[model samples]
Target chain A: MPERRSQRSIGGLTRRQVLGAALGAAALGAVGFRPRTAGAAQPPIRIGFCVPLTGPYGSEAQDQVRCAQLAVREFNASGGLNGRKAELLVRDSKLSPDEAATRTLELIENEHVDFVAGSLSASVQLAVNNITKQHRILYNSISQSDAINEPKDFSRYTFHEALNPTMTTDAVGRYAFPRFGKRVVFLLPDYAYGHEMTRGFKRVGKEFGIEVLSEIRHPLGTTDFSVFFPRIRALKPDVLVCCNFGRDQQITLKQATDFGLKRAMKIVYPILLYTARLAVGPRAYQGVVGGTSYYWGLEKTVPAAKQFNDRYRAAYGGRVPSDYGAFGYAGVRTILASVRQAGSVETDAVIRRMEALHYDFYKGPEYYRACDHQAVQSVLIVESKPAPADNQFDVFKILEVYGPNRVHLRSCRELGYS
Target chain B: MAALTPELLALQLLVGLALGAIYVLLAFGLSLIFGMLTVVNFAHGAFYMLGAYVAFAVAGLTGNFWLCLACAPVVLGLIGYGVERFLVSPLYGRGIDYPLLLTFGLSYVLVEAVRIIFGKQGYPFDSPAALAGSVEILGNYFPLYRLFVVAATGTIVLALWLFVEWTNFGLIIRAGARDPEILRVLGIDVGRVWRLVFALGTAIAAMAGVLAAPLQGVTPEMGDSMLIESFVVTVVGGMGSLGGAVLAGLLVGLVVSLTSVVAPELAKLSIYALMAAVLLIRPQGLFGRAGLLG
Candidate 1:
């Protein structure tokens, strides 16, 4: 018993051993930070945001949530809308159309959200569009659906904040026409967005004296793109444009490289924005030019853009401004301006304010277009630049900027909008 | 009549191989599960997602991609084995509907678990830096990463094929599948063999996930879409035949791709239609052993 007690005694303690144990504890303590409590508020205004909270577009969904929250935060800090506090009501649609429709009803009835917002998934957006129309409530849709602006699908209640596919490609066609020499091969996704975008590309491509050589629609999630490559290779167009979003965009670009499509012909991506950049490093995305709503370094041209960039960076702890985030941030700004114009949270008043008025939205050209209640914002044409260090969204040189007036849309009647 | 360059063909074939590889892995699991137990294992897709997430965490901690890839199957195999031992073993002599119900429930639970853990965001995993660039063939640029996917899947399939056909354990597994009770009469433990087969099948599915983590977007609900497709392949290939699965996988890939040139919306549903056609013609599947590819 005496020997056992002696053996248990600390006889050979080393400075290194003692230091190691102390360091381990210190490291764990350093990692654990104290959280702050949120201050209580009274009668907060609820703004419902229905996005793909659990699907392929979850990242974009999160951005939408943050932007809405940030706007609500700023609104409250700056004495809120009409001196009333604002709180966002977020519901995940899981990127399903039916679910989005259900969530829209829930948000409208159960959550009692004063205003409704668009989701990340275009399908969800369409669902919300129908639901919001039935309710005759305001729908500030960020869906890439031109149907929102189309007199046929457009409602007295629905207003679009983002660019339509036609609007997006209209600018690209105008800016890249002369430089790109317009021999185009369309590699569009085989879906509604793809079809609309293809139609838009061809419409503008033809106007700019660009020949539409050949068109091939690739399925949204096709793993092997080999079949499409042969067609593109055969055509050898001056510009090969791939109009696919999300993972499809990244995969297309990577696969295009492997097929040597770049060497044969100059490749043009209609849009290579945020989500694609994060999945594929900036270094891998070099030599590509695409359009965007805004960029952080683009403050000098827009004047009021710098404030947005600075505030957004501050809020997100200096995370770079992604297209989705900017869309969210600017969307909130648009809604705020409209809400101010409306003077009250009367849904009809807000819709009228959005539909009738045109204001200088600092994001891009013409700010907001009264023609369709869609932003006639500036689209930045940037070329990707390879980086020395790997970073998400580290790409592109700003090639050209196209404003809304320059990138005009054929009236709702022309587009069968009615 | 058609312009198909060497580089173009290479790229297309590489794409085919990559898709085929995924099919091989997917089909192998489907085949083995159906072969040994006569159950489709609809939850196989969930297991695949688990393997990917597991690889992701392990890779992040150790910065060892190969190690993550190697060990994912082992962990998944153990999990599959456990599932068989407890949840599945009781239903072994019972009706097939019971296991089907159990697996369907298990799939939902697995998906919900992933949702809880990963927070529904598409977790992006970068491909290994060693093979990230594009490879050119016939003036068409294709990703080397896809090529690597092809190589890896081919190797795994070949190894699996060899293991099942040549190895003594493989013989026992096959024999056990044919008549599990008879193997018991021969002093062999049929339960252990069944467990091994189940684990082996699941391990293949898990390895498929490890390969896909970099290539495909990872999400909690990713399994929902893939489960249906894997079933389509299994049904098309005639359930229990490994070769049938690979062939049907390529055929399905081509159909999906080529159809995009015409009708995009029905590109997915075409597989079901094909399965219907096959069922109407050869109900046992082209390779399944007389309705055994259940």
Candidate 2:
């Protein structure tokens, strides 16, 4: 009995504990609820997409996915990164922040993907930050939330390939100030993206001797633009700047046009140039000027862009893919650069390689902001052309290109990167 | 403050009307279902989303908008009927908790199923060639599609109102709600009426969805906001009162419009705020009866 008692204990683990475990196990009879993991050596190049694939911003995700796939295909065709054919194991965040974290785990554990790509919505980007950070895997955010760059939340393994609101604001101000001039009233989305946009525009506007009379914020997913419309119409500012995203952009613009604000005042913003064209169609948005990083029909002097656009239009039923498509494709290029330099599918090495990246794939100056991993690319200041002849995706006339320096980008190091 | 110039006010009104039309349709079915079932139907908006997706998928297959519209309600109604008989029927004698939980779970399941099946990406559904652009209305150019939606919704409300008053099935459904045990004792099969009520409610939601397809980008989450608003309308319009529902639907629409005209940010929010305000004044709601609560 004494010897049997001693047999029950084994170092830190008790035989009593083991016996307890064994009995408990016997009653339960092995639940067999083991979780699966992405196995052995062939670690897939996992790319996390935290976009609004199902929610209000779903259309944006659809366009983004197209760009991402195109970029990977292009990279693979060109012998991939370090001569290993690149693969993008995609996962959708469905636009909810909580869901973004939950879905990302599926990729991280099940597929054991190397890195994550941020989806279109900024809200989703905010959610994916720490979850991806804990894993120490790279999460490249295409979502335009500045929170990703702020000190409290910034991740070393994270990078942003899309425009921050500040970058967008500055680029638009640079392109529009000299031509359109800037006595502006900013109508922004009522969330963090709105704050970022309004601040960025105001900052750039001040630098360019422009005056902003008022900046108003509206809640996201507002179907009616009436309240803000009446106020903006009253302001009659020189540039009636709209800083909303996705369907909000469409609804706001359409309501603005209906309220005769377009006739009452001039209007400009990044989304006005792209999404508006689709929502209200070309007729309503015709002659509306705005700024964006890229346009489908910018007629790029750069051979790379030209080739990409041509191929993209061909594959996508001849309808032009928007700048959303370009950003997605460009994201692929950025990822390839990192993968090539890292010379492996390892996440840490890929992130290090991303930090050193400065690729020139455009006719104009473009650079990724080292501070926030934001791409400092050219913004096209465009005008809507005249008549039925130029009406087919010919919605905008090129006013100017705000190059990398014109926007005056800051990198992660400038943001006190360690 | 922006001055309310004639052009500005007129434009705001036009925009308000365009927005209000959609709100009316969203609230309509929820109101209709509440008028029949004492139990609130939370699954109405999910049906709305399903309708849009079905329309989109059907349109993708046949490239016909009319066919998609015609078929969506049938498919969704059948689905709604299935839920009523299986999940909702067992809980009929129980308290509201059972049906509420059941419908709420159903909403999540349906949303996730769509995500899993469609992979959460937006599928491109072409706008109807007929309703592509705007026409000059009320001294402003409004999208022709928006006008069509408003008109079609108006027609649907009127038809439903007429049918409920005149049709035998509608009368029997109304009678059952008044005395469900009597309905069962009379050998009228109250369960069948409950199932039919659910199917019809889902059909109405889908009707709104099909109409909305060309106007807004079809998305999986589209039905959610509508669902909340409809519940508000259902409560405010006095449960089981069809006429009250119509009034509440129009009221919500006007409230949304008026609020939007002055403050767009508060447009979607004003309905709930209005509901809260009304609930404070009259615990039963603006048109709801104390008798309906038991």
Candidate 3:
């Protein structure tokens, strides 16, 4: 009797009619209606990271991605710019300029990344900068390049997180010139990066009254440094400044040691990579003094550095981040921080926030120069440890910490900025 | 610029000879394989790289450079044997292209496998303690390891010459190289001869890899440039000619070293120029027999 009554009308409607109406409302709710919550309403912020993931710097690129991922994770955990989570879309730049441009375009046009970051090679970074500039997307370059800061290439959207060649060479030269000697010789790889490094060194050398003995331009990827060894030894300079990078740096340093050039002259690199030091081992790299953007040894004095290192170690199998890897973390973190400060992902708002923001995210206090958008940061003068330490990562001993004010970066006017 | 002193000139000459020794070892293997199998081993560089990786692994485990040197060749020889039997044997009589393609593909597979196992980073392999530092020579310092390399290559060359010229197995190899049909008619197992020749060639390449590892660290792509350079040496020395490989390797080394002094940019190009000039004059190569591949 109850079932029959239910099957009959409820007021003016049957039970089946009432049930159908409720089901239709539920389906509509499932399809369209939703609560406007901060976390649920907004999509994740996408950052396109293009790096040399398939070339000589592939290992470094892998470390960069790992550090960037840590940055994104940290951002999301910290409420994520008003409850909008962050995500990363990585693409292999292939250490080629054209390839980097193509990948950056894809990131902008198809993937619709809110911000762009990464590139290890100087030329490749410039190429990425051009693409991001055209699209009006914010780009944070995490590579050492003088060209990226030049007025010809600089744009409002471009932010260089890594130190330029000028800053690095200045730090190294200031520390090394008076100590090592006045006479310097350069073995440069024939490329833009090498050329820029040599230029920076020469600029710094002029200030210290150092004599440049000779500049030998070797082909990129020259495995045999034997032919150049005799030429270098004959020069007998007080310091041999090798302006090569990655595999070139490793081979040249190893061969230089083998040829006994280290016996006569001091070997100084503008920037000695942590990964390169690890790859070449202590014997080849030891006693070689150079400038670095970040050394995890800063953890002893800098609390921020200790925090970053601890988080990184916990995430990456107890391995500390390399100098280049730190750049990746800083690049992504700064971009997201700017978004949080601006309270929106709008390009202009983020740009304004970044320009005004002074941060000590990893190493120490750093601020973007308004004219060129270059990160003015501290450079550490470090020497390769003479022997392997208990911790393999403890390869470099910090000789001096040159703060941003001590490190001479090129002025905007000097860079042709009006 | 530093003056090209007589002492520096003499030192450069020694460097050229040292560089040539590596090319000769690599080219000799390529020539031997081509001589016996009539198949261009495009994977020669991969075998060389694997040899270095194997040497690195052995050296890491045992801490003995000499032991690593010995083990690399043995490991590579076994690998070469397996590759010939399972992968390459079926492609026989299908023309040179098939094996060449197969080996090319094999080279990529091997490189990828190494990349996956070892990672893309290069690892340093220190020279033996005895050869760690440089010795003063010709009024300049030269790495003791380079001198050791030259001496080692000379000894290897002499032993290889003796084995090929004096032994019965060498006779069978020579017969197989010239005419497998005749070797088959004489009741010899030509397939076994081919397999042995391939193994010997790969082992020699592996030895060269071990020798070069200390000079340049071991990496997955370490064999890439060596492969191209060795191919140039093989072609310039004349295809399938061991003596030609030796002579042409030294010649190419001298040309590259001397060119580097004047124009470092053109140093790599000088080798190709030498090849093109030689081909224009004699298409068969310096020691290659006429109409072999044609």
DockQ for each numbered candidate: 0.33, 0.25, 0.32
User: Number of clashing residue pairs in every model?
Assistant: 19, 12, 0
Best by lDDT: 3
How good is the docking of model 1, by CAPRI class?
acceptable
Interface RMSD of each: 8.7, 10.5, 12.4
Candidate 2's DockQ: 0.25
> What TM-score against the true fold does each predicted structure earn?
0.87, 0.80, 0.91
Cα lDDT tens digits, model 1, A93-128, are 876789889878977876566788767655567789
List chain A TM-scores, every candidate, in order: 0.83, 0.82, 0.89
List model 3 lDDT by residue over A344-404, tens digit each. 9999999999999999999999999999999999999999985445787898999999998
**Candidate 3 residue-wise lDDT at A216:** 85
Winner by TM-score between candidate 2 and candidate 1: 1
lDDT winner between 2 and 3, please give it.
3
Model 2 lDDT at residue A139: 76
Give residue A208's error in model 3 in angstroms. Answer: 2.7
